[model samples]
Target: MTIRRALISVSDKTGIVEFSRQLAEQGVQIISTGGTFSLLEKEGVPVTGISDVTGFPEILDGRVKTLHPAVHSGLLAVRDDEEHQKAMKELGLDYIDLVVVNLYPFAQTIAKPDVTYEDAIENIDIGGPTMLRSAAKNHAFVTVVVDAADYGAVLDEIKAQGDTTLETRKRLAAKVFRHTGSYDALISDYLSKQVGEPLPERYTVTYEKVQDLRYGENPHQKAAFYRKPLAASGNITTAEQLHGKELSYNNINDANAALAVLKEFDEPAVVAVKHMNPCGVGIGTNIHEAYQKAYAADPTSIFGGIVAANRTIDAATAALLSEIFLEIIIAPDFAPEALEILTRKKNIRLLKLGEFTSAAERKPEWLVTSVDGGMLVQESDVHTISADDLKVVTNRKPTDEELKQLLFGWKVVKHVKSNAILLAKDDMTIGVGAGQMNRVGAARIAIEQAGEKSQGSVLASDAFFPMGDTLELAAKAGITAVIQPGGSVRDEESIAVANANNIAMVFTGVRHFKH
Candidate 1:
C-alpha cells in the first residue's frame, strides 16, 4: 500500500516538522490536530486539520476531536477486503496510511513535587491513545509510530519503499501497545499513591533500562539494570561510576550490600562485603583508621571483596586500598591525590556516591522480591533498635560499654544473611558467620573466627537462639555479652545457659532476618 494520508498528534514535537515535510514532499496528505497543525503550518508544510476530515469541531477542550466515526472508520478500514473498501467508499472516508502519536506528559506532570490531582487528571491523553490503538489494530493496512527516536528509520523506509514494510508495521504496532501499557501503569501507580494505597489490589510497575551488564551472577546468564521512573536520590542505582571496568552482576550486588551496611553508621565507617555478606565493619575517628580496622578484622575475606566507606577517602587510605586485590571501592568522595593513585589500577571499579543518606532519611516504600512464578511485596524493614527496646532477661545486665558494642553488632548482623552471627568489640566487628543452616553452626563459625579475640566481645544473632547449644558455645568461647530477639520457644533454656555462665544478655524484642 503506497502512502496516501497520515495523521500526526504528539505532546513532544521533536522532529515532527521535518518528518511531516518529508511526508508532504512524498505527496502524502498531512492531517493534524491542535498544536501539531499550527506548528506544521508555520513550518510551511501543507496540512489539514481534524475538522476538515471529521467534519466536526473540537469540543470539551479538544477531548472530543478525534473520537468521531470518520477518523476511526478511516483508520480501522481493511483496504484489501472488498466489503470494507465498499463501506469506506460509501462513507467517502479516505484511508489513513499512517499515524504518528505520543501521549500527554502525565508521568512528567505527576513527578513534580507539588503537582495537584486535578492537574494530573487533565494531563491524561484520551484521544491520542484511542487513535493509536485503532491504527495499531489494523496494522496490516495502517502504520503507527509512537516514539520520536524512530522517526529517521521510518522516514528512510518510506522514502525507499514508498511505504513501511509489513514487518516494520507489525513491530511498530507491538511498540504502540507497550507504550500504552507503560503509560497506563504509571497513571495507575500515581492514583493509587494519591489514595494512600502504596500497594494496590493489582500492582503494576514499569522500569527504564539503565544498562546491560556484562553478565549475570555467572558467565552464561544475561542481565540488564533498570530503575524506577521516580526513584529516590542517593541510591546505589543512581551512583556514578568514576573509573573502572564495566560492573558485573555480582559486583553490583556486593557493592549494594556494602552500601547498606555502610549506611548504618553516622561516623567514619568502612564495610567490606563478600558474596553479599559483610565480612568486616568498623568505625573510627577518621576514614584511614576505619579502613585499617575493617581490613584487620578479616584480611583473608577482604582479599576480593567490595568496600564501602561512609566518608571521603583520603590519599593514605587509597594507598592502603590499592595494596589489596579488591573488585570495587565505593565512597562519598575521593581526594584528588587518592583518585590519582586509585585510577592507576585500571580494572578496579571506583564509584563516587556523594553524601550517603541513612534509611531513616530516605526510606524505601516497599520491598519487592521475585519468585519462580510470582512476586512477593511487603513493607521495607527499616526498624531501628534502641536502648529502651532492650530487655535484660538474664540476672547479669550489660555495662554501658557492652551495650554500645551490642548495638553496633546488632546493626551489622542485620545486613548479614541468616542464620547470621556477629562478634564485635570497641565498635568493630571481629567475626561474622553468615548463611549457615543452623544458629549453632553460625555461632560456632563466628566464635572460631574470633579466636582469642572472642574474649570480652559481644555477640549478636539475627534471630532468637533456637536452643541452649548456641549459648553454650558462646560461653565456652568467652563471649561476655549477647544481643538477640527473645521470642523462641527455647528462650528460657538459652537464658538459663546465659545465667549459668554469668554472661550478660539483652533481648531486642525485634528480629533482623536477611535471606
Candidate 2:
C-alpha cells in the first residue's frame, strides 16, 4: 500500500503544523503522541492519538506511548505481502506509511554548564527512534523522516506525485539509519564519560550534514560538509557568509587552520594559511596592523591563502586586503564599509564568525583518516603545553624575548604536520618545515626558508630530535635557542649540542604528534 498515514512526533516543531495540515489535505491520516497530539488538535487538524491507536493508554510518564505492537506492526507491515497484510489485519493495525520524528535535545542538554546526571539520562529518547527504525526497516512500504528540515521535500513530493516514488523511500531510509546511528553514538558517549574511561570500546562522532560540495578534493571524488555536533556559538561552521561565492574543499580546510592558529593569540592577531598550513602569523596593536605584518612576513605565500583575523575587519584592513587575491577572509566582525569594499571581489568568500574564539566548545573523541581499503582512528591531539609547563634543560636560561619566540614556535609547530620544524623571531612564525620524512630534512628546509632571518631566531620541533645532527644544522644557521617536547632517550645529546653553542633549551614534556 502507498503511504496514506504519517505518525508525527518531534521535539523541534518547525513547519510541523503547516506540514500536517498539508498532509491532511492530501487525505493522509496523522497519528501523534502526547504534545504532538494536543498541538495538532489545537491547530484544527484531526489527529489520532498513538495511545488510542495502540488500544492502550500512554503509561510510565509518556515513555510507553508509541512502544505498543499496534504502532510497530502498522509501520513494519508489508502491504504487498499476503502474510504481513493478514497479520496486520488480524491485529487491527492500519499501515503507518510515514514516520516524522526528531530525537530529544540531548546534545543541547549536556552542553549546559550545570547539567545533572538525571537531566542527561532523562533526555535520552526511546519511543521516537523505535518508530523511525520501524518505518525505515519497511522503507519499501513506508517513508521515515527524522529531520523536520526534510518536511518540505517530502510534502512537495507527495503533492507532485500524489504519492512518494519508490526511490525517495529508499533514500529517506538511508537518512533514517544515519540519524539513529548518530543518536546511539551520543548515548554511548555520555554513558562512557560517566564511567571515566580514557578510551571506549567504540568511539563515535556525530556530524550534521551541512551541504553537498560541487566535488571533493578532485572532480571525480564525492564530498560533503558534516558540521560537528555541539559547535561553539561562534565556530566557523556556525558563521554566516555575508557575501561572495560558495567555499571549496581547500578553502574550508585552509580557513579552518587559519582560524585555529589565530585562536592561540589573545592580542590582535592575523594568520595566513595555504594548503592547510600557516604560512605567516603576526600579532600587533590592532587587526589592521596585524594583517599588514602577517602579509609582509610572506607576501608570496599570502597570495592565495586564507586570512583569519581575531578582531573585527575595519575599512583600513579591507582597503589593504583589496590589493591581494585572497581565497577567503574570516573575522569576528566586518565593518559595514569594509564588507562593501570586500564584496567587490565577488569570488572571495567573506565569513563573519562572531564571538567564536576557537577555545574548543566541544572536543571530539577520535579523528578518522582514510586509506585505500580502511581508515585509521586515534584520539584528537588536545594535549596543551604552555611556557610555564616547559622545563629549562640547558645551563643558559632563555631570555624573556627568546621565551616568547619559543612559545610562538611551539604554537605553529603543533599545527604543522610531522615531522615539523618552525623558526620564529619576534612573536611571528618566519619559516616552517612540514611533512618531511626526517627531522634533519625538516631542519634544512626551515633554515633555508629562514635564511638570514634564522639568526637569533628560536626553533621549535614537534617531536624530539633522535640525533643531535639537526641541532648542529640549526646552530650553523645562527639559531640561539631550541624548544621541543623532549622524551627521547638521547635527549642529553640534543641538550649537550644546544649547550655547546650557548643555546637555551627547554623541554615541553608533551609532544604534539601530527601524522
lDDT digits (tens) for residues 82-147 of candidate 1:
999899999888888999999999988988989999999999899999999999999998999999
- TM per candidate comes to 0.94, 0.90
Candidate 2 displacement at residue 127 in angstroms: 1.7
TM-score for candidate 2: 0.90
- Candidate 2 weakest lDDT stretch, 10 residues: 356-365
Winning model by lDDT: 1
* Candidate 2 lDDT tens digits, 1-515: 34588899999888899999999999999999888889999989989988778889999888788998888888887788999978887877788888999999898898898999999999999998899989899888788898777889988988887777789889999999998999888788778879996466666767897888888888998888878777665656888898888887777778878876777777888999998888888888899888887887678889988999989999999999999999899998999999989999989999988986344433544667778986677775656666789899999999999998898778778888899999988767778888899999989988888889999999999999998999999889999999998988998999899999999999998888776
Can you tell me which runs of candidate 2 are displaced by over 4 Å? 2-5, 89-91, 149-162, 357-365, 372-374
